[model samples]
Structures are given as C-alpha cells and as structure tokens.
Target: MAALQTPKFVYMNGGLTAWEDARLHIGCESVTRGLSIFEGIKGYWQPDGSFALLMLRLHFARLKRSAMLLHIPFEHDFDEFSAAIFELMTALVEPSRDMWIRTTLYVVEGHWGENTRSDLVLTAYHQDKALPEPVSLGISTWRQPGDDSLPARIKASANYQNSRMARIEAREQGLDDMVMLNQAGRVAEASTAALMMVRDGVISTPPASESTLESLTADFCEQLAIDRGYRFERRPIDRTELLIADELAIGGTLNEITPVKAIGRRELATDTGMLATLRSDYFASVRGGKPHPFAELTTLPKVSA
Candidate 1:
C-alpha cells in the first residue's frame, strides 16, 4: 500500500478544520465500539489542471446506504456532501495532483445499543496514478462472516477486523494478500478487493450474494469487458479453480485492477492480456480519455468570495 500524503486541512462535521485539530472523544461509540462507516473515492488530476471525481454519486449513495444499515443517522443529503468535498479539495489539495478521499460517518456521542449522533469527516491526500501489478495470494484460513453474522457488505470499521486478521495471516505466510472464503467455503474476495478470474476467454467473479462487497471498480471493469465483447459472469468460484485459472485479478478503489500472479505455489498463466486491456480501459475512462456512463466527471465547485 502507498503511504498517504498528509493534508494541511480536513473537513470535520460541517466545516474546514486543521488536520491536527480533527478529533473524537475517546469515549465515543465510534472509538470504543468501532461504530463508523466510510466510502473511498478517487480524484484524478486532469492534464488541463482540473480535478475530476470518479463516480461521485455512486460512492455517496453507497455511503448513505452504509449509514442507513448501521443506523448512524447520516442526515446530510448528496448535495451537501458534494459541496463539502469540493470545498475541502479547493482548500487542502494542489490542483495538479491526483488524490484519494475518504468520507466517514461515525457515531460521535452514544453508548452501544442507543440511538447515536453521528459526525462526518472527509479527508483527502495525494495519490499518484499507478497501473496494477502482479502479486501473490494465499487462501486464508479465516472465513468471511456471513450476512447472518457480521455482514461483509457493510463498509463499517468493525467489519475490517476480519480483513486485518486475514492480512496478518498473509504477511506471516509471506504472501502479498489473502483470498477470503464465505460461509459456504467459496471464494468471497481478497482482503480489501473483489476478486475476478478469467478462464476460457470468460471473466468470472463471485457475486455479491456470495458475501462480497458490491464494488464500483469491479462493476466498471465488467462494463468495459462487456463493451469489448468479452463474456462476463458472476458465480461462486471454487478454490481448486483458482489454482488452474488462465488469469486472475482483484479490483477496488485502491487496488484498481491488480493481476494475481500466483495462488499459493501455482503461478497463473500470464499470456492472456485481458486484465491489462481492462486496466488500461479503466484508467482511460477515469482520466476522461473515454466517455462512459459511470465515469461521469465532477469538477471542483466555484469558490465564493
């Protein structure tokens, strides 16, 4: 993972605040019980010196849904959320640098099992554009929690404990990342991304029903695949199938579309250029090189005097 470039300012609650001054009480539910939900958004610095946010509405909609699911009482509408993000970017980020932005809604003042007040915090930092690289993966012993338990679909802070454990296991095993399985012992996703495999010229990924988070980046890749006349399917992926797959990749806001070079000791075939093609298309769309529905750009708002 790339280190974040610390910003001079951040948007907290409703206004701009110094990065050092943005704080939460130690006793808050968000701190004690991990009662927070968040969305990761990417911003591209166009060649013309303007910033464009990728899929702004889709991310915010998911953020709203996450708050609703967790009962975080996120009352801010889409417009207000967009305004705050733009304002923060205008104040904190250089216009020529690409950035990664995180918008989090956390329980600010309540104990467990009580209706809580929530606070919004938006943070953005410099992020450089990089293409996905091949990495090794291990099948984790840690299984993803089912919807009946701590669901994997919610982008909540508490849910990441599962990912944290899996990542630790992977590191100890000397692998780049871990592929988590759902309750049914089927492939769920990578620790922080949605996994996709290619076999027989067809692209396949485990469905959201299989306990994977509904990923915007994965969806964008699927659309690009379809437009390029490649067949795409969503189904349960078995462990054995991964070992012999022709190609494998993982996609997310941060991972983008990373190719998996190996699963355990078995190296996947690299001759197939499908992952490369899709990744190129994805970057192009995000940078406004290609026109697509999901890549609709949101420019910075005008600053008021």
Candidate 2:
C-alpha cells in the first residue's frame, strides 16, 4: 500500500485549523503523560458522490465514556461534536475514496495531578478498503493490563504502549501480530483488534470483562453471525484453544475482518468458508449494500461539482 496523504485541514477546539498549524504545548499533560482519549471512525464513499460515517454515534458514545472514565473535561455535547465532525469531513474528505476520521480529546495544559483543560482534535485521511491476506500471530510475553491497573475499556492513548510493545515483539518474531493474554492467563485480544475463534460452527470471542476493549466492530460481527444462524458465544478462551481452533480472526474499525493463518508455530485451518462470508458481509454492510441495525449512516454533504 502507498503512504497516506495528509489532509489539508483539521478541526481543533471548535474551529478549523490548517493541519501544519494544529499544535499544543510541549509540556502539556497529553504530551508528557499520554493523557488522551480517541476514536477511529471510518467514512465509506458512497455512489452518490458522498461519504457515510459508519457508527458515528456509537464512536462518540465510546469517546464520551472514555472521557468520563479518565476524568477529561469534554465541554461539547453530542450535537456540537457531530457538527464539528461533519464540518471537518466536508473540508478534508473526498467522495472518490474511503477515509479514517480520528477524533482525540486530550489535556492541553497543566500537570498530571492537577485539573487540566482539554481540547478536541479531529483529522482524517484516505484509507484503502482492500483486505490483506491471512496473517500469522504469536502469543506475546506482555500481558494486557487488567481493570485494576490500566483498564483496556477506555480508548486512552496510554493504553497503547502495551499494544506497541507486543506488536514490536511480533515483528521481531516474524509474525504479523501478537495475541495478548490477560493477567488471568486468558485470551484478551490481538495487538489492536479483538480475537475470535470458530469451532464446530460456533463463533466464540472473549468478553469485555476479559481485559479487552469493548470493540464495536467485534459486536457488529457477532450480531451478523447470530443473524446468519451461527451460534455466537463470549467467554474466556484458553491459550491452547487458539492452537486447535477451526478458524481464528481479528476484528476492528481499521482491520475490518482479518483471518489468522497460524498461532505461534501451529498452523490452523484458514480455508473455512465462514470467515470469507463474514468478511464479505462486513464490507457490504459498511458500504451501504445492506442495512446496518446498530449504526446510523450519517451522510456527508455533497461537494459542488
């Protein structure tokens, strides 16, 4: 894939700013302490010369929950934030390609222990929808932070250090990604996505209680499976279970649906028809080929011809 082009504009603190000029102080808590909450929303290009933001409301809802959990002050309500997102998309998004819109709420001033002001930043760039080939995964030595420590439920920037370390370990091992287990020795998730295992036609995934992010994409796919008459279960999965599963995959907003060809050195059956069907159905649903029950399609304003 080619490198992504930077967007010309970014929405910052209730107004539009040139991307190069959007900046914060070097000593800001967000910079020094990684104190920020964020969300990745995909905007699918439609045939009508517009783009539709998938799960816009749900992403914002998760952002709000993250803010509350982390004690970050978010002054703008849903309507205000939604309007700002649309404004940003209008300025940066094009109908010819899909885009990944990222919104971040971060501390702008003050030290770690003090009350700090927060700013909202929204930026977007084009993204390709093509799915990559099935990947190999290895279990990382790093364990996901439990709720008692740094909770994985909140989309905080600080939580990514754990993911980053595991990803680096995977790269060193010549694997695509790593599956992180919780402190309790159960499967948590992949470096940046939720893990799912299929066996005997049953789709199983670890619940949010298992030190994993409450993934919107994972939930959407689970719903798709249930609607298609596939039995879906959310429970603690053992490490050995992944090695013997009929199929494995990871799901996220960025990684829509990715099949796992192997775990560690053990290669599993990757030719299952179930994974392909889910991947196809997922892309179709997001691109408006079918109705989406959970996410409301917020269409961007049409650009003048």
Candidate 3:
C-alpha cells in the first residue's frame, strides 16, 4: 500500500521498523476497512529519572480481547510485547517527563471481505505536559452507542467518530468536555473518559455494563482506592443524582482521576469537597513508584531495565 504522507513512526509488523518504510499490501483488510483494534497506555516519570506504567497489564489484556473479536490473531510473544513496550516507552518518555503510549493491532492482508489476518502495529506518543486537570464540563446533547450496537467493546478506529461528534458539538457550544449518555439516557461517560461520582463519602463509578470500554485506569483507580480503605462502588448511576454528588471524576489512562466541579445547570459543590486526599494519593501513585500496588497487576516488572 502507498504509505500515508505522515512523519516517521515505529511500526511493528511482527518486528519493529520505521512504519513509513514498512511493506504491506493495499488489500490489507485492516487498512482497507479499519479491521483492527488498539489500546492507549500511559506512563509517567519520577524525580529519579525513571518511569512507571499506568495499568499496563490491564491495557494488554484488553488488547487481546480486541484482537479476538476482530479475528486478528495476536501472535506476538507476551514477554517480547512487554519488552517492546518498555523499550518504546523509555525511548518515547523523556526522563522526568510525563507521557502517553498507544499500541495498535492490524491485519496484513486477506480477501477484500475476509476478516481474518494477522498483522500488528504499535505506536507510542507523549509530551512533557501534565495530565489535563478536571475542568468544567458540559452535559452532552449527544448520546453513546450501546455495547450490542457496535462492538463498543473493541477499541476499533471507528468508535471515535461517535465520541468525536459529541466532543465537537460540546466544543462548538463553548464547553470544555461533554458527558455522553447511553441510549437509555442514563449518564454513561465523557466522550474521552469514564465517569465517577462521589456520594456520602464514597467514590462511585458507573458499571462497565453501562459503558463500551470497561476503562482500565478507572478500574485501577477504584481498586487502589479500595485497597487504601476507601469505599469504591460500581452501580448503574441515575442522571439527576449527578448534580447532588459530592464530587465527580472522569477516569481514564491519561485523564487519571481529575475531579469535576459542576454539571449542566446544577452547580456541583467543589470547595470543601471530600475527594482531595484520595485524588492526591492517586496522582502520587501514577507519577511515581512509591505506592505501587501490592500485587503484580501490570506487565511492567519489578526491576527496570
């Protein structure tokens, strides 16, 4: 296939190479019809010139599921995948710089209509910028697609169109970001991240049953919070109750646990709010290795290379 007129990229078609120079047929199903899946992974740096991955294993596990659904066999070795990510992240994340990583899987080639092919790609990008602070949000005038409707479970390239439409509408309306609702009109998630609401000293997020992607960072935050003795609950959330909640956070790989101050017309109480310490602790864990989780949950190993 003729290459895209873009800058150089590190692409792995079973082996890593400069993607712009890699060879693939135009009939590659993944390229021709978006027959691929991908994941976004993030890592951050510490004062010691080292870096840490946020929810690494969780992201890979999700990637495997995405591959299975697309029938794109993920043939790479696990340890190799981990090492590649480490090497790639270390190369991409400047020492003491915050970063984000993106991994992709695609089909090399097949019949125009056939769905099964085995080709893979990985790309990681980041800047020294800090994670976006939770800013004021606009309740989306748009809604999210149901899980059954679009294989919302798979992080397909196409899913973002839905998210894009909502986000564009929100931005045009002069909003920072918008919270999209499910077909049920129940509060689902923000166009980019998962939604959380605090009530009565508890941090609550809507269940995955309510979202397309069971967000990895959000789940990790909830688990870490619970392990630290904070009560974290997952349940179907009601739309009206969002306004009265003590605090709200949109959780994701990059967004982390930034808190929200308001929704639509109802002004959510921000000052004298209860989630300050929890938020601090979460940032600490993400930006440094001091409070690493007790168990080996991520593909990242105990010893750094």
- Model 1 — which ten-residue stretch has the worst lDDT? 296-305
Q: Could you give me the TM-score of model 2 versus the true structure?
A: 0.94
Candidates sorted on lDDT, descending: 2, 1, 3
Worst 10 residues of 2 by lDDT: 296-305
Alpha carbon lDDT of each predicted model: 0.85, 0.86, 0.69
Q: For model 3, how big is the CA root-mean-square deviation? A: 4.2
Mark the regions of model 1 whose C-alpha exceeds 4 Å error after superposition: 1-4, 269-272, 302-305
Lowest lDDT 10-mer window, candidate 3? 294-303
lDDT string for model 3 (171-203, tens) is: 787666788778888888888888878888888
- Structural similarity to truth (TM-score) of each candidate: 0.94, 0.94, 0.84
- How much is the lDDT of residue 108 in candidate 3? 76
**Candidate 3, which segments miss by more than 4 Å at Cα?**
1-8, 19-26, 112-115, 129-131, 269-272, 294-305
lDDT of 1 at 256: 79
